[model samples]
Target: MHIAEITAVMKLPSNVRYEYFIKKVTDFEEVWGLFSDAWATSKDEDGNLFIPFFPKKEFAEISAEKEWALYKARSISLDDFIEKWLAGMKKDGIIPSIFPLGNDMAAVSIDVLLKDLEMELENY
Candidate 1:
């Protein structure tokens, strides 16, 4: 199957966040226009990554009891297009997520504008 857009959601603190377009990827208007949910979790967790596990689980488990599992998607191989897009995006300003990088307190964001990622399974 063909992938339209890729979004990698990550959590972050309330400050030091992304606030601009890194690159103008073609056919990613829908992804660019839509705002991805990112934020910090409660102060009880070991890590501050505020990932809502429900959505992830919904995209996993293929069972006889749910349809949300239909949203699950898998890739066949990491295509060169993804690398090219990421390189262009990095050059344009999109950088690696800072969750485990530079700072500990920063706003969360998603940055998967990679292109032409072949899908082996697009249950979604």
Candidate 2:
């Protein structure tokens, strides 16, 4: 995907983008994230840290600018994301920011994401 396509996806409504994230990740069996020395993260007004993920590498690539300049897009297999990452993130109280577009994102809990992904996969 290119920047133009990404821009269109970004313009999509929050719930639509969230659905797109889940579908794309499950369809590809992978999720994209920006990483350098650590995973790329953002904070809410309350100062809670959340790691952002993308359903497409292009999304991650476009986000890897400014403060995230040193970060590179990396792919995480869905299985690892589910069986390992999610549980660890849940224990650590880290929110998963799905398909963020600027200041907007679907910042959901690990359990919520897991349940949604499971439901989506059930249709397959």
Evaluated with TM-score, which candidate comes out highest?
A: 2
Report clashes for each candidate as comma-separated counts: 1, 0
Q: After superposition, how far is residue 36 of candidate 1 from its true place, in Å?
A: 4.9
Candidate 2's displacement at residue 50, Å, is 0.1
lDDT for each residue of candidate 2 in 1-124, tens digit (9 for 90 to 100): 7768787888898789999999999999999999999899888889888999999998898889888999999999999999998999999888999988888888887888999999999988
What candidate 2 gets wrong by more than 4 Å, as runs, is: 2-4
Score residue 9 of candidate 1 by CA lDDT: 26
TM-score of 2: 0.94
Report per-prediction Cα RMSD to one decimal.
Answer: 14.6, 1.3
TM-score of each prediction: 0.20, 0.94
Query: Residue 19's C-alpha lDDT in candidate 1?
Result: 21
By summed lDDT, which 10 consecutive residues of candidate 2 come out lowest?
Answer: 1-10
Best by lDDT: 2
